[model samples]
Target: MTTLTRARTGPFAADYAALKAAAWLTPARERAWERLQEAASPSERRGNERWKYTDVRPLTSVPYRLAHAGALPGLAEVKKIAPWDDAWTTLTFVDGHFAPALSTEPTGRVAAGRLATATASVQSLLEARLAKVQAIDEEYFTLLNTAFLSDGAYVHVPDNAVEERAVHLLFIASPATSPRVAHPRTLVIAGKNSQSKFVESYVSLADSDQHFSNAVTEFFLDDGAQVEHYRILAENEKSHHIGNTRVHHMANSRFNSISFAIGPAIGRNDHHALIDGPGAETNLSGLYMTTNGQHMDNNISVNHEKPHGTSRQYYKGILAGKSRAVFSGIVVVKPGADKTFADQKDLNLLLSPGAEVDTKPSLEIFADDVKCFHGATAGHVDLDTLYYMRSRGIGLEAATQMLIRGFAAEVVERIKLPALARYVEGVTEKMLPEFRLEVPK
Candidate 1:
């Protein structure tokens, strides 16, 4: 394995000084920068368990510039791609910088804007909940996200406000004059008895040049609040994407998170949620599809600190060509978390001989009277099922594609949003091989 080296006085180090001098430094930002300085050095990837299956040597070997203001020119065509209809409030950021001209105004009792220009109360809420769920320790990618955080999404729903429509945040990465990187941060604070929906999408407008996107999001749900969060990643295949999300649930709060990943040459997502008070509930579901030489990693963990908490996690992946996928999940029930119920399942389907996947699911229970279970499975499509379909006059190749679709449809069906689920199905359809198979023209 080849080792990568990074220059000490590279773009990141230079950005640190420039940001500090430009008054972009906050107490929290300063703390994060100091932490990154200590841990962001280039080193051998063999020792880190997180980097075992994924080779990130290219990250340090290349020196990419940081995204700057007005780096992307004004383009009208690039502003038309939105995940949701006009019924939903949408916020769009180009190259990690908030684009007000392309975003829709919010309605009702919702505070949605850029984190850097958010209200004082919203900033206070972020400060109180940013790292409260998952601390930054030994996670170099997350620390890097914190250190370079500039402008991203910030939303707050006040108490008793039930938002009828979902809030959409779209982050689009465009090719710069040179290879560049963007650190986008999102913070959401849901007050007591509040209910809302959030959708986050990371995409690219350009097709060719290599870019890197490092993003982090934090969600704080007060008691009795309910929020459904959806994340979609479909960057350019030549780009690199790393995303982290930390969710904190208070007593009786409910959090539902669903994610889909389909692009990027190398992509990794780390998600963690904490049940701080009693009776909190969480449901996490995800799907990742890769083809050709792409590689993806999804790491998730949930900690139950109070009793009567329930969590269910299920993730599925479809690998084709020589692509590789990794899924690792952990559920922990701490002491005094009696009556906690947790179930986790990870399943992967390999369509090609060269496709590969690594799945690991774990449960740690330190409390008595808790119900916990975890299981992981990786294998090719069921031969028997395919045979039965082929016997019914369906071509073998088409039958195999149908079986793969059914395997992934299980997770897609779990998505409550109808349009989103259909969008995922469409993406899945396009991802499969278009074989004539004597079945379709």
Candidate 2:
């Protein structure tokens, strides 16, 4: 195995100074830079509360350069990653640059497109909210995103409006020779009494020798608003992916988050949400599959800051080969936030003896009259189920795949959109054949 050389200078040393100002996003970009300059490198971060169970030195070691627009991918190639659906409007970005020729602009009671073409109101909204949700000083990659933020998309759903079709943002990372990086930012503003569904997916053109994609997406849901969000991640073993997402819920608003993950050398997902209003609810669930020697990490937290708020975090993972996965989740109910209800669970199934999983599910409750609980379990496939399948004339490998699919059904079933769920199932089926399967000893 080839090892990446550690950087002689501090991480992302030259990359920060090279960020040029954009047209309208210059102010926010400059602010992020000012804060990032004072932030500590990921290597300097050492603790169980934040950096436990995952090491990102190899990722930060590679000298990083921001990716410029490469050749536009053909429609067929783009569709291969995410199939086209008439009921959904699509926005495609290739190597961090918005690809207008290959995307379908959102229509009907919504204003959405590249930031360069945003209206004054939308641009102003982004200026105030770009790095607002995730403080730049807190996380290294998130601050890096805003500091070097070049190009991305934005959406605004009007009050009392219903976006008839789901909006899909497809970010494709093209193959590169060097360890290039792309900071793709997406901002969604849902107005009061509005409702919409969104799909955000990350796909690689192919496995590159060295590549990094640091993406951040923020969604703010106003009172009585409802948002159903689905996130999909598919890179390669040679590339690295870091996804940071923040969702804010207001009074009477509800949010449903369903995530699917596969591929990448070191894939880390940071999902955080704040239930800040009474009668608000959030349902968060995800399914991640790891194979070969890949490393996948999911760090999730939901903070209930108001009374009568509800949140759920349920995640399951299937592991094969010698891969390792980590799930660290927490539910925080602050003082004065009484009548909060929260539940969390993480379950893992290991197909090979060498495969491993580290799961930590916990809760911090400082409020009275609240209900919060968490549990985690890791184990191997059941031999009795294999025997039963074999008696029914199922081949060993096929039966194993069937069991893995069955294990993930609970999370997949939670996807409320029928068409989207079917598409996710199809993608999962395609990835099943590539797993480096080994019978549990």
Best by lDDT: 2
Model 1: residues >4 Å from true position, as ranges?
Answer: 1-10, 20-25, 40-43, 71-82, 434-441
Cα lDDT of model 1 by residue, 321-378, tens digit: 8889988888999999999999999898887777889888889999999988889888
Model 2, global lDDT: 0.83
Which clashing pairs does model 1 show?
Answer: none
Kindly report which residue stretches of model 2 are placed more than 4 angstroms away from their true locations once superposed.
1-15, 134-136
lDDT of 2 at 72: 90
TM agreement with the true structure for every prediction? 0.91, 0.94
User: Tens digits of per-residue lDDT for model 2 on 1-441?
Assistant: 222222233445576667555678777777766766566555544443466677787787778788877899888877776645766888888888889887886789877888766778777876776667744346667877877777788888889998868888888888787778888889988899898988898888876567888999998888999998999887777888999999888898999999998888899988999887888899989999998888899999888888999999999999988899999998999998899999999999998898999999989999999988889989888888899999999988899889988999999998877767877888889888866457744
